[model samples]
Target chain A: MLMIKTVLHFDSVSFRYPKQEKGPLIYDSMKFTVREGEFVSILGPSGAGKSTLFRLITGLEQPTGGKILLNGEYFSNRLGHVGYMPQQDLLMPWRTIWENAALPLQIKGSKQADMRISVEELLKEFGLGGHEDRYPAELSGGMRQRVSFLRTILTGSQVLLLDEPFSALDAITRLSMQEWLLKQWEKRKKTILFITHDVNEALFLSERIFVLTDPPVSRMEDIPVPLDRPRTLKALDIPEIMVLKDRLIDQLRTKATT
Target chain B: MKKWREHTYSFILLVVVLVLWEAIAFNIKMTFILPSPTDILMKLWELKKVLLLEHLPATLCIILIGLGISIILGVGLAISMNSSKIIEKAFYPLIIFSQMIPTIALAPIFILWFGYSIWSKVLVTVLITFFPITINTYDGLRAGSNDLKELLLTMGAKKKDVFLLVNVPSAMPHFFSGLKVAVTLSVIGAAIGEWLGAQAGLGYFSRRMMTQFDGAGVFAPIIVLSAMGIMLFLLVKWVENKTLMWRKSE
Candidate 1:
């Protein structure tokens, strides 16, 4: 079997806020790796420093100690190697869906004509056809999220980091979005590190899940879901899924209490 | 339909006010103190040649030039201030202090310096109009959500790209809002400057009329000035609406 390269690696990372010199560390000697073309989800409780990890990866914040390697290259406090979708949609209210999605390409100094063509094609594939002229306010929440997601993918990065992308969606919409995302991931074959607090979501989407304990994230449990490809809602009914879900939940509950 | 109703109501109120004015003027029998609407209209028609030919052009020229200068300078200053924390810290207090010195009080000084020329009036208009635009644009530029800025930075966007794409567009609504106030004030500023000292303008003409106790003449230019103010305000509003079509007007 061909070896899948690691797209993102955190080698014994440590971080703490500057203002809180005496406070408890947010991360202490954290370590993880995401393979190329794999869907990996980071599952943790609230206030578990998941966002801080994302900031560090995106180069928005610098790690106090340790190294972050992207595509086998170490980058400290630098951005633009990975695609990032923030927790909020963050679509400019003044811009249309097409313009908003085209922003990444525009920033890269792509020709307007080329940007429009690519963005339009992607919008159609995202099931947002014929909504090119509509502003952010006119779109539904789910549609907005899809537009945001489309924008992230258009950035042309090999790895994508989504920070709780569907957290604000209704349960039904969130489920549908997850399925849609999985379909997109399979087609694109890009390395994706998804962050979510929900155990079921993590199980349903990722091949391997990183269950992080609350802050100072000193240790993590990596659970592998040996499920078949092209998963559905019916995957939740499988006996193995149930067993893993209970085990993961018990682990999280115990960690939370302790 | 709603707009039509509003127009009809305004017309009715205007007619009621005019009728009351005519009744009061007739009862007092003092055209010098309070001219009847007919007297004012007659005077407007009589002086229409001089008013439209001589004074209106001068006033319009001064107001437009003043407004143009204010917009360019205000927007420039706002962008500069927004780009640097040091500039913002240094200039913000001075800008506020400038506003405290009433433009009306300084109008005479401008007139003295510029010697009753159109420049004095333009300066007054600039002084009156620029502050709001600068302040509003500055606030708008700074008001961009941090998440959006961070997202842009992560997308490999340079600082210039962020300013042009995010800050400039975001500042537009506030710019238009400031323009509305500035446009209305431009008329008053021009009038004040002309009133202080001017060879020819509606303001100068009105002052002459006031001194001569020609109530109808005074009232004619006053009506024209108010109309000019309203028309300029509406023009700014129309442009704002066209430019910011994404904004739903409440």
Candidate 2:
């Protein structure tokens, strides 16, 4: 078996917002690791500093103490190594779907003709083939999310961070999007760090789940999903998976109370 | 079909208004106090040669030149002001203060300084038109989402890329709205400047007609000036429609 290398490591990271210097620290010596090609979910309630963690990892904000390592190298507050999809679609209303998806490439200074050709194929694969020239206002919520996702992927980063990308969708659409994302993940094999409050989603998609306590997260528990590969909706009913789900819910409830 | 109906309704209303004016002029038995629409139209036809040869071109040139300068300077100032908080704080109050001083007050000063040439009129137009563009563009630039900015930053985008990609496009609607207001004011600005001092223009022509008590002649230039204002406004609207197709409703 090939050895799995650590793609990202959080070495006892600590952070406190500058405005609230005297307040409790947001991250108290937090530590974790994501292996190469792994799908991990950070499951926590709202205001658990989950977004703050992403901010630190994405280099939008620097950690006050400790360090973050990407591929065994010190990662500072610098962008471009990781792709991020914010909560909102954030598509430029003035741009067509094709133009919006090709933004990262444009930012990287790729030739327009080449960028269009490449983005066209990606749009087709993502079920946005005929909608390339359409404005964002014309697209449905799911289609817009797909375009945003395609834009994130086009950034060409090996590590992807998704911040509640489907929280805005209806239940039916969210399920379909989850299934589609799982398929995409299996095919791409990118290291994904997903942030969500949905336990079922975390269970269905990720190989491992990190349950974080409320803000000033003093502790974190990592639980592995020992399920078969190429999962389906049927996997949700598996006896062991149900047990794990109940366990996660209990942990979350307890954390909320305490 | 709906748009055509609306236009047809507008034409009927205009015809009714014109007939009413003609009735009133006939009852009064005087062309000076309220000239009939036909009298105005006939005067316009008689002065068409002078309008085309001299006044029309003069006014058009001043307005176009003033508008062009305003757009360039306005957008440039907006970009610089948005780029830094200190610069914005220093200049924002001064911009508002400039607006408070009526253009009428400044027109004579501009004439005194620049002389009775086209420069004074153009300068007055610039003074009136640049404010809307600058203020609207500034508001639009600042209205860009912080989330989007952070997303771009994470993509390793440079400061220039963020401004061009996010800021400029977001400012389009606001810029167009400002332009619509500015273009209408530009014609008025030119008229005011010409009222202060000028060798030739629709304003100069109108003043000459008014002093001579040639009511029909005065009405003729006023008609031409109104037409000029409408044409310039429509031109701006047409450009805005073409460039901002994204703003169209679904």
Clash number for every model? 0, 0
- Residue A233 accuracy (lDDT) in model 2: 76
Q: Report the C-alpha displacement of residue A24, candidate 2, in angstroms.
A: 1.8
Task: Give per-residue CA lDDT, model 1, range B102-221, as digits (tens).
Answer: 779878888678997899999999999999989998998888888999999999888898888888898999999999999988998888888988888888899889999999999898
What are the DockQ scores of the candidates, in order? 0.62, 0.72
Q: Which stretches of candidate 1 lie over 4 Å from their true place?
A: A254-258, B7-10
Error of 2 at B232 (Å): 1.1
Q: RMSD for all candidates, in order, please.
A: 1.7, 1.6
Question: Which TM-score value belongs to model 2?
Answer: 0.97
Model 2: per-residue Cα lDDT over A13-89, one tens digit each: 88998788898899888888999899999999887888998899889999888899988889565598889998889
Q: Which candidate is the best by DockQ?
A: 2
Candidate 2 clashes between residue pairs 3 or more apart in a chain or in different chains: none
